[model samples]
Target: MIDIFLVPIALVVVLVMLHAWFGVGILKRGIIFTDLAIAQFAALGSAISLGYFHEEYFYILTLSFALLSAFLIAIASQREIKLEAFIGLLYVLGASGIMMVLSHSAEGMEHFKSLLASDILFTSPNDLYKSAIIYAFIALALWKILPKTKGFVRELLFFSLLALTVTSSVQLAGVLVVFVLLIAPAFVAISLELKKPLLYSFFFGWFFSIVAIIASYYFDLPTGYSIVFLGALLSSTIVLFSSKKNSAQN
Candidate 1:
C-alpha cells in the first residue's frame, strides 16, 4: 500500500522549490499570470494526449506546451498590449479545449476531475519521487543560469524557468494549488523584507508547505486545498502583523 499522504506532502515541497526559483522572476517581469496560464495549457496537453496516449505522456506534452506558452507570453510582455488580457484569453481557451476534448473522448467525469483538481490520495511515492526529480533538474538549471547569463539572455532564461516551473507545478499540484504555491512564499518573502529574498522565499515556501501537509493529513481535507488554505492564512497573518508593526513604527 502507498503512503498516500506523504506523496502529496513531498509534492508540495517540490512545488515550493519550483516557485522559489521561477516565481520571483515571473513577478519581477510583471507576468504573475504565467503560472495559471501554463497550468491550463498543461490540462489541455493532458486532455489531448489522453485521446491517443497514456496519461503519463501528459507530462512531456504539458512541458512542451508550457515552453511554447512562455515564448508567446514573453513576446506579448515586450509589446505595448496588456499581457494579463492575453493570459485570460489563453486560459479560457486552454481550459475549454480540454473540457471539450475530454467530454467527447472519455465517458466518465473522473478524467475532468483529475485535470481540474487532483486527488492527492491517488499519488504514490513513485509519483512524488518523479516530481522531485523533475523539479530538481529544472531548479538546478535555473540556479546554474542565473549567475552565468546576463542581458537579454538572462531575461530569456527567466522566462524558461517560469515555463518549466509552471508546467511541473501543474503536474504536481494541479492548476489551482500551483498558483498558491507560486504566490504564497513570494508574498511572505517580500513582506518579511529578507536580505536574501530568494533564500528566504525558499525557506518560507518549505515551511508553509510542511504546515499545510500536516494540516491536511490531520484534518482529512483535500491536500491541495489544505496547502493553499494554510499558506493563505499564514500570508494573511504576516501581512496583518507587518501592517501593525509599520503602524507602530509610524
Candidate 2:
C-alpha cells in the first residue's frame, strides 16, 4: 500500500515545488488565469490529436499549441489592450475548440472530464519521469535565465516556460488541478504575508495534496477533484479567518 503511493506522492512533491514558484510569479504579475488558459490550449491540442489521429504524438501537438498560446500572450502583454480580457478570450477559445473537436467522438465526455481532472492515481511511470524532466528544465531556466532578461523578453520567457509546464502538468494531473496548484497555495501565502512565500506555498500545497491523495484512496473519490477540493477548502478557510482577524484588529 505504501509502496503503491510512492510514485504518485513523488510526482505531487515535484509539482508542488515547481508550481509554487511559478504561482508566486503569476500572483505578482496579477495574471491569475494565465495557467488555466495555457492548460486549456494544451488540452484542446490533445483533444484534436485524440479525435483525429488517435493519440499519436499527442504531447507534441499539445506542446505546440501551448507554446503558440504563450507566444501570443507574450506579444499581447506588450500592447496597451486589456491583457486579462485577452487571456479570458483565449481560454474560451481553447475550451470551445476542444468541445468542437470532440463533439462527434464517443469518448468526448470522458475525454473532457479527464482533461479537466485526470486520474492521477493511475498515472504511468513514464509520464511521471517525463514530467519531472520537463519541470526540472523549466526550473533551471527560471532560476538562471529568467532573472537576466527584462521587459518583453522576460515576459516572453516567463509565459513560454509556464506554457511548457502546464502542458506537461495537464497530462499528468489536469487543467483544473494545474490551475488550483498554480493559484490557491500562492494566494494563501500572499494573503498571510509570509516572508518566504514560495516556501510556505510549497508546504501548503504539498500538505493538501498528500491529504487529498489519502482521502481519495479511502473515500473512492476522484484524486484530481479531491486535491482541488481540499486546496480550495484550506485556502478559503485561511482567507476567512485572516479577514476576521483583520476586522477585529481594526
- On lDDT, the candidate that comes out on top is 2
- Worst 10-residue lDDT window for candidate 2 reads 241-250
Kindly list the per-residue Cα lDDT of model 1 for residues 1-250, writing each as its tens digit.
Answer: 2365556666766677777656676666666677788778877787777865756677788878877776777677767898789988888888788777777665425666666556564577776787678777876887676789876566666666777777766665678777777777787776677788778888887887777666667777776666667777887788778854457667
| lDDT value, residue 13 of candidate 1 | 60
Query: How many times do residue backbones clash in model 2?
Result: 0
How much lDDT does candidate 1 score?
Answer: 0.72
Model 2 lDDT vs. the true structure? 0.92
Candidate 2, residue 158: the lDDT equals 93
lDDT of 2 by residue, 123-172 (tens): 78888888888888899999899999999999999999999999999988
What residue pairs clash in candidate 1, if any at all?
none
lDDT of each: 0.72, 0.92
What lDDT score goes with residue 111 in model 2?
Answer: 94
Query: What lDDT score is found at residue 98 in candidate 2?
Result: 97
